[model samples]
Target: MTTALVTGPTSGLGRQFAIQLAAAGHDLILVSRDETRLTELSMELSESYGTDSEIIPTDLSDRDQLAVVEARLADP
Candidate 1:
């Protein structure tokens, strides 16, 4: 199973990308400042497509948070 990392996954293209990827049977690493929305989307994807997601509550504008995301990407 492939895993995809998506930033700003709570809305717009990122959200659509996550959905499409989930439909195609990819596990997800979803990143966003909005943890609630991320959790909602994760649950929705899981229920809809049996998708599994790891949500990261991150604001990429913060360097420290961005570093966390970078590390996850490197190792995930």
Candidate 2:
């Protein structure tokens, strides 16, 4: 299975990306600062498409958190 890392998924293009990717059978790793919105999106995508979605609450402008996200992607 292919996995996609989509940032800013709480709204706009990011949200659309998540929905489209899930529809295309991709497991999603969603990153956004809004925890509530992220959780809501996760549930909606999971229910609508039967696809697994993981949410990481983060502010991308923060260097530290960005590093954390990079590390997660680097994991085997």
Candidate 3:
């Protein structure tokens, strides 16, 4: 299945992107500082669109945390 990796997914533009991507049938990897919100969004998306979602809780400003996302993106 195809996946969309969305940063800041609990708020603002990223949240909108996550919703739309799920509706379009993409699985998700949601990166956000707020674990609670990410969990809520993941469940909602799963129930609403039947899309799977994974949550990664980290502040993207941290270099180490950002590297995690980069590594995921590098995967084939």
Candidates in order: C-alpha RMSD to true structure:
0.8, 0.7, 1.3
In candidate 2, stretches whose alpha carbon ends up further than 4 angstroms from where it belongs are none
lDDT for each residue of candidate 1 in 1-76, tens digit (9 for 90 to 100): 9998888999999999999999999999999999999999999999999989999999999999899988978884
Candidate numbers sorted by TM-score from highest down: 2, 1, 3
lDDT of each: 0.95, 0.92, 0.93
Name the 10 consecutive residues with the lowest summed lDDT in model 3: 67-76
Instruction: Write the number of the candidate with greater lDDT, choosing between 1 and 2.
Output: 1
Which scores better on TM-score, 1 or 2? Answer: 2
By lDDT, the candidates rank as: 1, 3, 2
Better of 2 and 3 by lDDT: 3
Residue 59 in model 3: lDDT: 88
What's the TM-score of each model vs. the native? 0.94, 0.95, 0.89
Higher TM-score: candidate 2 or 3?
A: 2
Highest-scoring model, TM-score: 2
